[model samples]
Target: MDAKELIRALNARDEAAGPDLLARTKATGPLEIRGELLYAPLVRNWYELTDSLELIPAKAPEWRPLQCGIDERAQAATGYLLALAEADVFSGVVRLSRGEEILFEEVYGWADQDRRRPNLPGTPFNVGSMNKMMTSACVGRLMEQGDVRLDDKVIRHLPGFRPDITARITVRQLLTHTSGMGDFFGPKFFAGGRHRLETIDDHLDLIRDDELLFEPGARFEYSNSGFVVLGAIIEARSGCSYADYVREHVFEPAGMRSSDFPAFHELDGQAIGYTNFTAHGAVTGPRRPHEDTLPRRGSAPGGGYCSAEDLARFGAALMRDTLIGPDVKAALLGLRSDSGSGRPGGVPYAHGFQVESEHGVLSYGHGGGGPGISAFMDVFPDQGLTLVALSNYDDGARQIRRELRRIFWPAA
Candidate 1:
């Protein structure tokens, strides 16, 4: 349904969902509710069933970029997206690359609302899930060095990997999120008495049951635990911590000076995080020090931060074959899993990146979101366009990406 109607349904069907009217607002700050009303649905056959209404606010998931043909129509569409991002109705940053020329670069929104700090082009922010791509890149470098193989069993590296996983999962499975490992930050850790562990090894205590979401490699299920296990593999095989391996190989090789894995030392120019507090009439302030609010430094499963420009530079370097061998990099971007209904080899999931399918068009990249920020970077190979968007606010980054895709590839 439309944003309003769906909101009304949620409010009426379950008062607990709304709690107090205008519980929290969007990136624009406290919203003014103009008397709620319910009406027709935005799409047919879509219905709301449950409205638990817990304030479990979350950032949006990243959308893949479907390659678009570079023609007159596509160019006009791309221009329109540039204009929309400039309006600042949505906080975002995007970069479009065509060969050696930089076609589009822009930033919008308040980095810090109260201090009036704008999110400049070079501003650094946490690229939550986007870190997974970097994590995969770290693994790729190790593979290039013959330190690990895609077919290697994860347990072979993890000295005392949970018994349930030691004999069942593969490196490729973990990279593709098909290992059936439970989500590392979910209920198993939240509910069990072992949520305080900070390192990847600290998470093993909750892996005792080692339940698979599905048979290994049977289906694609996004699991943070899969990445955590992958991190362990990197540590065990490389004889280096995940952060160090990535810094020495991926980041340094790509010349991404502004990017880094979250470390225990002080970081310069790190964007502060924020969350809304409706208890005192929608007070937006710095995130508290709870497990959910404070970011853990050693989190290899996610939470690497970077600037928009650095990400674009990395994409350009990757396309030029300066980072990894052309053939090996291509295989890393090629389809390695069938995640949906499509041609025999279609639905995409590459080694450490995401493959996009839009009719005959294809693109590869990854997006990341965390408590205080969200980011996405997709490289359109044929079009030579690399689109990067990062936001300081929580959930709005995905919407900006959706609108960008709609502008560039309407059919997608």
Candidate 2:
């Protein structure tokens, strides 16, 4: 059924599923919502569900590159993306790469629909929690410098944390999302004054007194606050702000000139992020710009910007060990936790990266987006391939990423 019919069904069938699903979606940190049809990052991707609106409840949950003569597959992928664009279902960039050479690239929709400013190849899109990988790399750098250790307590690096809460957390737990720390985004984040959270300290100040949701190393959970704490720790130990550290160590060395934590007010050339969910997450609402819901600037946990090319460059750097030393790289990319809570089957996580394995082939990457922002990046090390999909429309990159995955990888 269409959205209208589906809403009718939901109203007759249940009353509170929208808010519950919205809460779970917000907890994903990127705040991804596509009206009644939303998906959580990493934890849940969209599905071809039945017409019954499956609204009651639930929980949440890739491919190859060039060098092959797969014209039909390539054309099919392009057609699917074009259909999404034509139907106003997507607005963003989809880039598939084979090593340094691009295999398929497409730009869709307007960066500013009113001014008719179309999103260009270099247009920076808010990458949401994908920035966690960058934050993870900064931690790795500190580890290599011997300034921090995986076993180090949060209190060791960030003494300002409540000892009882922090003593139970470790650098490794934070990286692997087993820290038992919850996210910083919820009612309080959107309650107001988020614009004042311009620095890591500002965000940390908000979560310093938080209660741990579980014991450290209890299990795998996607904790945006955990990454925020990592950002603060990076600043405290390296004596450099997280942004500067990323720019110097992660972006510059990887040739990612267009990636950085630019302030929301200064988003002149960046894509204007849009969303359908209110801060309260209206399951069905008119579309709106996504900036007013943001902080003054992006933080360690998420809210950074990057172009498709730069994102691909960053992925390549991760695979080449340019972002961290060999040992750290190997450890960070190895599957560290079972991520099959309600997610796609057989998916596991390693530190900050999401691992997808099928038919004895492995792909490492992360998905980031929420509301008016959608992005996905993956590197098939065994195949020498990379995929980057970014969008300013609500869950814009999701469809492109999903369809491409069908072309590149099998269900088995």
Candidate 3:
């Protein structure tokens, strides 16, 4: 069958057949056209577009020679990224840099779908969980000043912490997401309203009474509440609010002039976050505004606005030891857990960065996602390459990153 017919057939299949049958069918072979393979993964109830290219044949007549050199690869990457943008697969800003030189940069899609404001190269996008890196840097600075220690108990900083539950949880555990604390985004969060939970202390009631998911340091479990507690620690030790501390210590030092944790309604050159639905009813694709889906303001664990260029600047600063000392930076970027074992891309988890091994080379970065935003930033220190992608749509950044990685590191 042709592509359209194949999609129709796939869509007509019984939903009760489930992912197992779909996986089995996909394993048979993807449809091939002009040397390219097409495989769509199941998303929720339907097949969604994904990047899963696998070269089965030794050679294809339509294939071009591999551009392995840096300049050649950069050109190929730019062309590929433009094509993806043209095809509506990628949206927002992307930048790839080597050392101090930017190899490629492009912007796509709309910042405000209603106003038709095109997403400029400097458009700030909400980087959901990526703010954890900034929080980590604040902790690192506090550690450098002899204000805190990794092994120090959580109760040492937050006196209100439960003696029985959080007493054994250390700062290190919080940083590495091994503290066993559960997330704060539960029934209470929605009930309490986002505006009320504006500060680190504001989230304490949500977490203070809750029990741990497991014993501290037992395993790797992502805990947004753990980072909230860390933010409290930063405030208690540094005598500054989480946002203020990060701005002064992290963003300012990193030369990230365009990054901030603004209130939800603030839209100053930042993209208007969009999703597929609103409370009114089912909205059309890419047009539904996510105004009620965001917090009044961002906090320590996540929810910060930054441009792609600002993210690249943050990476460069981390590498140059501008934000934290060398020892602190090393600890912050060090591999602290094997959290990526079963992850989609097999990328390991570092202190605040995601570590990925491509062929024999390693790269460090982080990705963030939420209601209507997705973001990714990577720094290949060995090759002096840094990549940053920020999108206004929830599912836009991942596939773009995948395709760009293939362009730069084809062997992997």
Candidate 4:
């Protein structure tokens, strides 16, 4: 097949590109094609070409959020969310701010279905992978304190943590998902095994032996295992557990009183996650409590809870160098890697943030979604805008975010 035709087929997921075809397509180099996985710019995501000739979406587009209010000019945005709420699709909070001014804010749906408790603007929702920002900040705090360096080997802080495998990985690589460590998800993680892992140190037992996917500092791959190791390093350097370190250094300083990796049982009146996702990341049917699909609690990689206000506080603090220093924040948010990491082309992964520039507008943020949780927060530094959307229903934040984006940045 021709190069263009091959790219079209791969993107459509209708025709599989074998090794010979992939090599041929790479030689063409006309469509920004990468080896093994296809980087389809049109889709703004990466797809893995399995041996069976099936194309699987590796990750979703990793950027964009918005700020606006309900007015005649923004009726579409407001109506869109109201429509979803009417359909029982949206359940959580949407907060938008320009500096200290709240441009828009609202809450909808039930926090507790059985209790008939409605969601409030203050309700905390599990932010699937959004916790990675704080994990990054934790590492940055240590970096500022001279307790760690990005280039230092992971084995330095976590010497006993898979020394044979971690010796080659660096702190920067781990933060940027370039450490080559795969995720801990499997039948074991989804099955009854998750309950046994309550603490960050306990998760070391869950890291698979066959975790290495590529050489250190190679291509970018989303890794829960890498963050797990970073969490361990945070504990070792701070002379305390990772949770304690984050609470004292990351959250308290940032005024994120409502954010933390609280366990399911420890939670009090937080919005319960409602997911349609099964263990394998597939939607089964209607949304329900996602307790069965969750780990015992959130950890370094993600699964922390936060309210929109708390997240706004975090974004502000992060930008203002409240949790980390100026140079540290800039270096962490700088484009450090540009491998095929499922983000839009030219939008590389920063330390923990995803940096993007579209239509001459620069923004950085992170998104997390799984089953009953869909959370996203973005900061538009030039516009002085911070947008946060947190939800309890399965993939509920997407529509809200898209509408808000259109409302605020219509041409984008």
lDDT of 3 at 43: 13
- Which segments of candidate 2 are over 4 A away from where they belong? 1-53, 56-68, 283-285, 335-346, 410-412
TM-score of each: 0.73, 0.83, 0.83, 0.80
Residues 330-403, candidate 3: write the lDDT tens digits.
66666434221212234566566677776666777788886678899988777767888888875668545665
After superposition of all CA atoms, the RMSD between model 4 and the true structure is 8.7
The superposed Cα distance between candidate 2 and the true structure at residue 400, in angstroms, equals 3.8
Give the candidates in order of lDDT, highest first. Answer: 4, 2, 3, 1
Question: Per-residue lDDT for 1-412 in model 4, tens only?
Answer: 5447765666566443444345333322233446655663321336665766655656544455344434542455566667667666678888877656777787889999989998888788999889899899999889988999988998888877788887899898888888888888766787667887788876888884655899887687888888888899998988888878888987898888888888888878799988766644543346678887778889898888898988888888876778888778877887434322333234567888887776577777888887789889888777777889999887678535545654666212
What TM-score would you give candidate 2 relative to the actual structure? 0.83
Report every candidate's CA lDDT: 0.61, 0.75, 0.72, 0.75
Model 1 regions more than 4 Å off: 1-89, 188-198, 203-210, 263-265, 276-291, 336-347, 408-412
Which residue segments of model 3 deviate by more than 4 Å? 10-66, 277-286, 335-346, 410-412
Clashes of 1: 4
Q: What is the lDDT for 263 in model 3?
A: 78
